[model samples]
Target: MSDRICCPLCRCAEVLLSKAYPEQAEVLALLREHGPMTASEIRAKVDKSIGVTAINNRLERLRAFELVARTRYGNGWKYIAKPEVES
Candidate 1:
């Protein structure tokens, strides 16, 4: 397989895949399914095989990319998927 990574926004193959941050895709997929969730909720939805820290890191990256939005809910924050608009 090629090392090229597709941009989740434009779906273009311009994004250089990062091995250091490999869990991004999986996290995005999960968000697409069960987003608008808190970090703990996300941890619960994810496979028990993965580490909690890894999921948190992936969430941080996703938030930075604006693929997900973090909202303040009570004392904690909730993550929600930023829907892509079809033109």
Candidate 2:
């Protein structure tokens, strides 16, 4: 059986995003609240338990989900949360 929960009234994408990993949600919130930020910057602001590599992983996953986007920034990359989709 699938591990994800489904709601008949919700959009598929919205349901998937709602079920995203906690770390991914954190990363998204940081970008939305603080504007674009590098992985290193996110690492510094995220929970101490979340490491640099984990931060990078979450960023990439969020990107794949189209919930976030990245751009070249200095020598590294900066990520920002995509604008929320209207219901």
Candidate 3:
């Protein structure tokens, strides 16, 4: 059943981030490549024209799955990917 799916976007959310949402997935890939970085840093590093607020919002959404982590940096937060957990 659809309800059995771990993610509505991907039946196998564990392995299919890119397929679930390519644009949003880019945020994840970017963090993986850059390590910990502020939302503004992430926005600048990405290829698209998204706003910093949007990047911050995406980071929050990604946090729902523990796909991302955050640490206080200066007066704001830096987002980073959680260590990949293999099954």
Candidate 4:
């Protein structure tokens, strides 16, 4: 993956990703830094208030934006951050 992860929404200064979707950004950063990981693993490292379901929800939304992708791993799924999309 070349260690370069990027998302239009993440790069957009207008939206201020940290302020707008802190949880989502944190999730993305985790995946980018740690390589592929299951949703449960993400839930474990994220804020105590964020649950597995919420992590899954964030993964789904990230998938919709092409910022991250998930692959079947055993009985669960592992997510990987996608490279930057050229505008």
Candidate 5:
């Protein structure tokens, strides 16, 4: 991977990434590399071994932070990264 760990939302520099959990950072990086995806897809995409429950939890947390947006997709939600616009 490219190692440029900027926030998928907010465009925060690597410094801001420290605020997120390691898993959350990984999730964001995955989304950035790919695109919008479901929690399941994220779990499958990440290189490290992560559980579905953990991936789902991180997705929910990111969405709650407005770093990512979720849309209803069948029974689950499809998550997308939203760039944070400065006010």
Candidate 6:
């Protein structure tokens, strides 16, 4: 089929390292600490210094790379670390 592969953690790292996005780094660290979390939850845990749109953008990138999975949690989205990458 195709030769392209997706990786969220790598994408996250690339983006973060490319521009030194502090928010991205903070989010990654939070994810590592708390395991999995929704965008709103992460924002809250991170002190809401960054806006929702930025958080959403980062989450989208993470999801695309398959680094995280998004699921419906009641009325909002819940993000969890992909089990395959836990190691």
Whose TM-score is greatest here?
4
Model 2 regions lying over 4 Å from their true place: 1-20
Stretches of candidate 6 exceeding 4 Å from the true structure:
1-22, 84-87
Q: Over the stretch 1-87, how does candidate 6's per-residue lDDT look in tens digits? A: 111214766555546544665555566556656877888889887666787778889888767766567888888788775654321
User: How many residue pairs clash per model?
Assistant: 0, 0, 0, 0, 1, 2
Off by over 4 Å in 5: 1-14
Q: What is the C-alpha lDDT of each candidate?
A: 0.66, 0.76, 0.75, 0.78, 0.72, 0.66
* Span of ten consecutive residues with least summed lDDT in model 3: 1-10
C-alpha RMSD in Å of predicted model 3 compared with the true structure? 6.5
Total backbone collisions, model 4: 0
For candidate 5, the C-alpha RMSD (Å) to the true structure equals 4.0
Model 4 scores a TM of 0.77
Error of 5 at 15 (Å): 2.4
Per-model TM values vs. the true structure:
0.65, 0.74, 0.75, 0.77, 0.72, 0.61
For candidate 2, the clash count comes to 0
Q: Per-residue alpha-carbon lDDT of model 2 for 1-87, expressed as tens digits?
A: 112224543345544565767667667777878889999999999788878898999999999889789999988899987776544
Order candidates by lDDT, high to low.
Answer: 4, 2, 3, 5, 6, 1
Model 1 residue 18 CA deviation (Å) reads 9.3
C-alpha lDDT (0 to 100) for residue 14 of candidate 3: 37
TM-score (C-alpha, index-matched) for candidate 2 = 0.74
